[model samples]
Every structure is written in structure tokens, then in C-alpha cells.
Target: MPTPRPRPSRRRLLLQAGAAAAVQVVVRPAAAQEPPALATLVAQFAGPQKVREGRVKLEIAQMVDNGNVVPMRVTVESPMTEADHVTEIAVFNEKNPQRDVARFQLGPRSGKADVATRIRLATSQQLVALARMNDGTVWSDSVDVIVITAACLETTTSS
Candidate 1:
């Protein structure tokens, strides 16, 4: 004969319900809020909260064979001098789970405001690169890329 399973007690059921309710209360607000857009992220990145639409070069392939790891490079046209140099460079993606992709810090001694890296894309979308200068001015540029194989997309198996 098969052994019967014991039923949970009333107190145990109440405790579980209370815990679930607490979790819901904590998570509801976050779920209701939408993620910040790329422009908003750029504004937050800029020290003075001002952004110029160009002067930062964002280089990426127009079409990517795979989205798993796409090569990207950002080069800002700056002298990289003590009085005028690039302070930071931030990369943001439109369709990714997280908007911010990468951030590179540089100073006058660095001699250059360029960065190269591989980033994963969730899908075909536009990417923005913003550079903050030591003079408190922010510059930005964007590129559109088509990804054949998307990254971070969940594939479901049929039972």
C-alpha cells in the first residue's frame, strides 16, 4: 500500500500565505515601474545633465551574424589634455534587459578616449554612446545594428 501524505496544518497554511503577501507588497511597486529609457540614462550619466547629440563615435557592424558577442568600439574626438579631456564613456542599448552596457574612465594622462569591447544584444536595436568631458560637457552618438541571433532570449521546450 502507498503511504498517505500528511496535510499542512492551518497555522502552517496561514504562515505561507502571510509570507507570499509580504513578498507581493515588496515587489508590486517595482513591477509597476518601467525601466529608464536610453536618453534618460544618458542624462543621468552627464554630470551637468546636458547632452550634445554628436562628437562621440560609436562603431559597430551594421548587421551582426550573431548577437551572442558583438564587437564594438567607441572613440571620442578629444585632445585628452589636462584642461580638456574625456572623463567617462558610457554605452547604452535600447532593447537589452539592462540599458547600460559598459563604462570606461579616462583622464588627461590616458592620452586617448577610445574603448573596445564585446557586448551581447538581446535583439536588433539602436545603441548609444555618451562621453562626458572634464569641462562638464557631454557628447553622444548612436548606431543601429541588426542581430541575426539574439542573446538573452529564452527558448522554451515543448513537453
Candidate 2:
């Protein structure tokens, strides 16, 4: 084998390191930004409505054994009449990469004010349910979930 090439000079190595660090600093913000929290998501959708409790029921396990798919159900007390039906139900996860899990739009034809679905939880956090009534009012409820094993990708940090 040919003689090993001489190691890079200290000055050149330091310059290369500085360049690499600068590139990382430039690229980090875009790749590391997270989505808005649950409360912010609700505010964005509802636009200044007072969120009231007790009118809606959010059924989710207090502790989820798996985070890939957690069962969730939401029910609202509403007459399924043309004038007062629950028109929409939105599910949000407070700690997920994306806050809004899903939104189901209903109408008088749905004949009920309830919905059930499975959602992905990023971590142990609160899940919120928002119900929009046919009469232009919104109601909400929230429940906490304890996640023993995280399912979502861990947030990457560069030091």
C-alpha cells in the first residue's frame, strides 16, 4: 500500500468543522419545527368561542398500552333534529407531531351525535374533543393519557 496521506492541517480541520456547524445551524430550524399544540389548534378552528365542559363526553383509556392506535370515542348530548344536531367532531392530540388527529363532519342524516375512531398518540398528553352544533355553537372536552411506551418517532436533537 502507498504511504498514508498526511493528516489534514489543524487550521484546515477547524475550518471544515466550522463549515459543517454553519450548515447544520442553517438547516435545523426547518427540519426541527413542531406543529402547534392542541389548544392552539382548537383556537384556530373555533375562532374565539368559549370552550365549555360537561356537555361532551370523551371516552379514552387513562393509560394506553400502545401508542400506534389508541381507541377514542366522543359523544355529545344533542337532539338529532334539523335545528340542533352535532355537525362536526374534531379530535386533537396535545403532544403529537400533528395536533389534529381527525375531523368528522356530520349532518342531520347521521342521526346521532357520537363518533369513534383510533388515533396515534405521540406521548402521554391530553386529548381534546371539539363538537360543533348545527346552531353555530362549539363544545369541547379533554382527557389525559399515560403512555408507557411511545409510538411516534422521537424528536431529534442536534447539539
Candidate 3:
């Protein structure tokens, strides 16, 4: 019959666990734990092209009693003709679970580049709206919204 191996001591087991944890701490990178910057998210959506400011308008309240349903309006200055028109409109939020809030597609036949809708805000944070033209030029606008009552976050606090 083969001989049985001796069980490891409690102190030896604890020392091995501590060494493993230290190795993990040394191997993991710090930046990987951080959330992506809002600008990075915007750039990802806009593609590799440069993004300009203007020709886009975003309207939302600076302060609100509730974030469950906040009114939002975005207008892009475009003639809405076959030669010149807004191609797409997208909304992004800083504090939401996801960076993108909504996106809308349009064309010259639409006759207008204005959109009105309601979006949920997690808390007090910034919201960015971007519009793309037929020629591939992009325009943007941003607004800060304060939510007295949060819609996405589990807890809320007012500043």
C-alpha cells in the first residue's frame, strides 16, 4: 500500500494565500479599474474624423425635480435639401449605465432636423448631442442637467 501524505499546517496555508494575493496586486494594472472618460466615448461614436462645435443645439433643463422623464430637444441647423441635410443625431450621457442615450437617423426627405423626446437621467451630469451632416461633417453641443431624483442609480444625493 502507498503511504499517505501529511496535511498542510494552517500557518503554511495562510502564507500561501497571502503570497498569491500579493502577486495579483503586483500584476494588475491600475488604469484597467477606471471607467472610460466621456470624451473617449464621444470620439468612439464620431469615428476617426474630427468633430466640430456648432450647428447643433441641445435643450434641456439645468435643474429638474425628477429624472424619470426629462424633456430634451435637439436641433441641427440644416437646409434639409438633397444637397445639404443632417444625416444622423445621437445623444450621450456621462452618468448613465451606458454612454449612449439614443440615436436618430434622418435624410433630406425628412424636411427637418429637429427632434424632441424624453430621456432618463441618472443624476447630475453632462449630456452631449452630436449631429452628422451629409458631407460627413460633425457638429456637437452639450448641457449639464441636475436631477433632484435619480432614475438609474439606486441611491440619490443632491448637491
Candidate 4:
């Protein structure tokens, strides 16, 4: 019987191996790094606007049993007028990396300066609601949260 064709030549095998290694290097996912604090995230994303306290209202549970879907609401006392309406609202979580979770933009037609949504928190920490008005002023409010079972923590720690 004819001897099986010798395996691919050594040079071809080495070239194939090198190509595979290159592909692996290219396909690897970005490395995970520690997430910044809520205030730092806000500062980075908020630009140069002056962030003022107490103009926005943030509502979150004092104790959250589940971190996967924590309820949050934000309201700003604005008339929603053509000239004075809220332009944007952003949510930030203190314990989560990339804490700026969601942003909503509103106009005069929105009728109210309020928004509600569920967000994920990595652990027990503070949550912040920031609102930007049409006149270039930024308002914010924050509330501390206590998470009994954080989904991210559980998943990361394999507990």
C-alpha cells in the first residue's frame, strides 16, 4: 500500500500554527478592568457642565434584594416649556463599572420631566440622577442603596 502522504511539510505546519496564533491574538476580547466610581464616571461623561445638587429627584429602594433589576425613577421640577424643558436625564450607579447606565433626551413635547427604568448595580452603593436643562444647567440627586444579593457579585465570584 502506498505510504500515506507524509503529513504537511514542516514549514507548512509552522506557517499554519503561526496563522492560528495571530488569529487568536486578534479574536481575544478586550480585557476587563476595574470600573470607575460613580462620581468619576459622571465627571468624565458630563463634560465641563457645572453639576449642581438638589434640583433633581432620585428615587431608589433603601434596600434592594436583587441587583439585576433595581427600580429607579428620576424627576425634575421643570415646567416643560419650550424654553425651560429638561433636555436630558442620565443615571449612574456608584458600584458599577461604566456606571452611566442610561440616558434619555426630552423635549417640550415630552410633557413631563420624569423618567423611570430598571438598572443593574454591581453592589450596594449610591445611585445618582442627573438632569440637564435647555439653559445649560445640570442638576443632580443621589441616594444610597443596600443590595442583599447582587447579581453581578454573585456571577463574578461564582458564589
All candidates: TM-score: 0.72, 0.72, 0.73, 0.70
Misplaced by over 4 Å in model 2 are 1-36, 154-159
Q: After superposition, how far is residue 75 of candidate 3 from its true place, in Å?
A: 0.4
Tell me which residue pairs clash in candidate 3.
none
lDDT value, residue 146 of candidate 4: 69
Look at candidate 1 and give me any clashing residue pairs.
none
User: Which ranges in model 3 have alpha carbons more than 4 Å from their true place?
Assistant: 1-35, 154-159
Lowest summed lDDT across 10 adjacent residues in model 3 is found at 27-36
Displacement of the residue 54 alpha carbon in candidate 4, Å: 1.9
Candidates 2 and 3, the one with greater lDDT = 3
**How accurate locally, in lDDT, is each candidate?**
0.84, 0.79, 0.86, 0.79
Model 2: lowest-lDDT 10 consecutive positions: 27-36
Give the runs in model 1 whose Cα sits over 4 Å from its true position. 1-36, 154-159
Counting only residues 3 or more apart in sequence or on different chains, how many pairs clash (N, Cα, C under 3 Å) in candidate 4?
0
- On lDDT, the stronger of 3 and 4 is 3
Considering summed lDDT, which 10 consecutive residues are worst modelled in model 1?
27-36
* lDDT, candidate 3, 4-106, per-residue tens: 9999999999789768756655665744322456788778878976889999999999878799999999999999999999999999988887778889999
Clashing pairs in 2: none
lDDT of 4 by residue, 1-159 (tens): 888887789999878976875565456455623245656777765679878987799988877778889888899999999988999999877667656778999998999988998888887677778888998888888776767567665345555
Task: Score residue 83 of candidate 3 by CA lDDT.
Answer: 97
